[model samples]
Target: MVSKRLFQSVAEQIAELIDEGAYPPGTRLPGERELAEKLGVSRVTIREAEIALQAVGRLEIKTGSGVYVSERKPASLGALPQASAFEVTEARLMIEAESAALAAHNITDEAIDELETLVNQMSSDDEGVANAADERFHLTIAQASNNAAMVHTIQSLWQMREQIPEVKATYEAVCVHDAKSRTDEHRAIFDALRARDPGAARQAMREHFQRLLESMLEATERKALEEVQLRASQSRERFLAAAKFG
Candidate 1:
């Protein structure tokens, strides 16, 4: 019998294949029997693997048709540098505080106008549009800093958030919890920058990340509690079964 973990391993392998363009977007995946034969796993295991990928928005299942790769692929699920949401937020606090301070000194009227536009877009009710605008707003600040290296560094960090599945998952969960607060935080940062107050900008940036760190800790604790409860329930079920058998 294949272990439960094997299902996840198989899912990761399939995700790698998708990442490598072996199965491009909108392409139909091979049947479960074919995948089982190719991977030396049972059909049931293949089904579980497909389910895992589907959960992350990597695959689309069409009833009466077939499984196809989703147009929007998820972050690579394979082995990659995994950073906790807190660590990413911590790194942002360090780097972005300085970026915001520099932007306050070097930002032009044109950049401020652009930032205002992005902030308005971020306040929209649409999550996707708001999220994209949020990213652009930060990158715009990096650009205003007039440091090519800082721009490159900040862009690289954002790309990592997109490419690492665990980080993306954690951040998505956090976003869902308190997204409205982020708009207010961005506004505070913008206000400090517009006033050309470097110290205020830096403080605002740091406070934004401090809130994120607190949220991450709360989410982590809640997840741990859920897992503990699940394990306890499983143990109780096993005990009852064994008692009945004895």
Candidate 2:
């Protein structure tokens, strides 16, 4: 008999297979018999796992074709490094909240001075330098955590930092308020850190990230939907024009 954890583990593995374009969105998975044979699980366990995944909006049951992966990628997309946009934002929010807590408890005058220096050098005037300094400011707080592991998260953070420019630009193209929104939130984070109130710092960071995360997710999905609709409209127009000419 497969343990519950083992069954869940296999289920997550199958989810990852779908997320990495192995199955691709809207593609039906193999039949229960094939999946059971391939993964060495009973059909009963597979059915249970499928129900769990389907409940999470990861899989869509196609009546006769098997399980089709939905557009939303699930946690099975690997360690989040290879995750979808939604997963990446969620992971960042989680890590950043903890980093803010550490900053609140452990930040010192020295760290603040370092932060101010970094902030002073920050130049939205120069987009490239501004982006790097923004990253440096966040990493500084993580370092103030006095946790080597947190500081060593630089490798993953680097990817996040690099993505910030494009993400920021995308938002910029959409609205005028994002820059002020970012600055205001960062200022709150710094203030909370200076107060040495861990709860306040964490909450401030959490709320800040929550707003941005929601904005990013909503905007991305809406934009994709809009693009699809726009293309559909154009296609219809072309079909009408061709009918008139022919």
RMSD (Å) per prediction: 13.5, 18.1
- Model 1: per-residue Cα lDDT over 220-240, one tens digit each: 999999999999999999999
* Highest lDDT scorer: 1
Q: Identify the candidate with maximal TM-score.
A: 1
Local distance difference test, each candidate: 0.80, 0.66
> 41, model 1: CA deviation in Å?
39
lDDT of 2: 0.66
Q: Compose the digit string of candidate 2's lDDT tens values, residues 109-185.
A: 87887676656545366544444456657767776787756654532544443334554344444334465566667
Give the least accurate 10-residue stretch of model 1, judged by summed lDDT: 73-82
lDDT of 1 at 66: 66
TM-score of every candidate: 0.66, 0.58
Write down the TM-score for model 1: 0.66
